[model samples]
Target: MNSIWVITKRELSSFFDSLTAYILLTVFLGLSGFFTWLYGSDIFFIGQATLQPFFSIAMWTLFFFIPALTMRMLAEEKRSGTIELLLTKSVNDWQVILGKFSACLALIAIALLLTLPYYITLSFIGPVDHGAVWTGYFGMLLMSMAYISIGLFASSITNNQIVAFLLALFVSVFFLIIFDVLAGNFTGSMGQFFNFLSISTHYESISRGVIDSKDLIYFLSISFFGLMLAETSLSKRNIVE
Candidate 1:
């Protein structure tokens, strides 16, 4: 537990020291704000007292940004041969993985927190669907967790950050887009299966203020599976060395 917190803080400090955190926060806020207030189907255009536009735009923005954020979590460590040094310490593989995951998730949560002004502004504009807005934020966090784990897994399998970034994006695309498309093209059990595999399905469900157990399970399953894979990969590497 203390080990995990140490790694989390170390990773976070590195993010800030390198200016990655600032850049990510700026870009995320810029893009989300642009589409939510100034671009097509913006709040003014829809005239709705909801942050759906922001949520929708954020879904896509985070989809890309998360890979970039996580690309170096383990890949750079492996590339620089620091992973072995760290693993030789008191912490185990799972602690390291969890710490990196927590750091990335915390950064994302901060990004989302900065957007609270959007919710506050909506409240002033009209009657906002407070329940739906909160749920939407919750859904974003879950979705981010799933992707962060996937990204960490990708980072673990290779020592190249670019390869990790691309791999993570490729795997995430299946859950974010491909499965949704396949679900639309199929029917019966096939469609149902694809729908169940689609992250969008669960995210949309939660964003609509319907927090089903199944939705929670879908995100958790993906996150846990990805983290397990990452831990396994790291363990194998340690054994090889």
Candidate 2:
């Protein structure tokens, strides 16, 4: 537990020290804010006390942003041979993976929290559906957890940050779009299976204030699977060395 927290703090400090956190926060806030308040299908245009626009834009934004944040988490460590050094310490592969995962999730959570003013402002406009708004935020966090784990897995397999970034994006595309498209093209049990794999399907369900156990299980399963893969990759590399 202490080891995981130590690595988590170390990773978070690196993000801030490198200005990655600042840049990501600025761009995420800027893009989401623009589409939600000033650009197409904005809040004023809808004239409703709802953050659906923000939630909608954030889903796409996070899909791309998370990979960037996680690309260097392990890739750079391996590239610099720092991963071996860290592993020689008291922590094991799972702790290392979980630490980086927690760091990335914490950064994403901070970015989302910064958007709370959108909800606060909406409340002043009219009677806001507080339930839906909070659920949407919850959905975003769940989605981020899934992607961060995927990104970490991608990073773990390579020493190149760009390769990790692209790999993560490629894998995410299946969950984000390809599965959804496949689900549409098929029928019966096959269609149901593809639809069940679609991140959007579950995300939409949760964002609509329908927090089912299945949706919770889906996100948690992805997070666990991806992190396990990352740990496995790290372990194999260690064995090879």
Best by lDDT: 1
Kindly list the per-residue Cα lDDT of model 1 for residues 1-241, writing each as its tens digit.
Answer: 9999999999999999998999999999999999999999999999999898998999999999999999999999999999989999999999999999999999999999999999999899999888999999999999999999999999999999999999999999999999999999999999999999999899888998989999999999999999999999999964786
TM-score of every candidate: 0.98, 0.98
Query: Candidate 1 — which pairs collide?
Result: none
For residue 233, model 1's alpha carbon misses the true position, in angstroms, by 0.4
Point out where model 1 deviates above 4 Å.
238-241
lDDT of 2 by residue, 152-210 (tens): 99999999999999999999999999999999999999999999999999999898888
Per-model tally of clashing residue pairs: 0, 0
| Backbone-clash count (model 2) | 0
Deviation in Å, model 2, residue 178 alpha carbon = 0.6
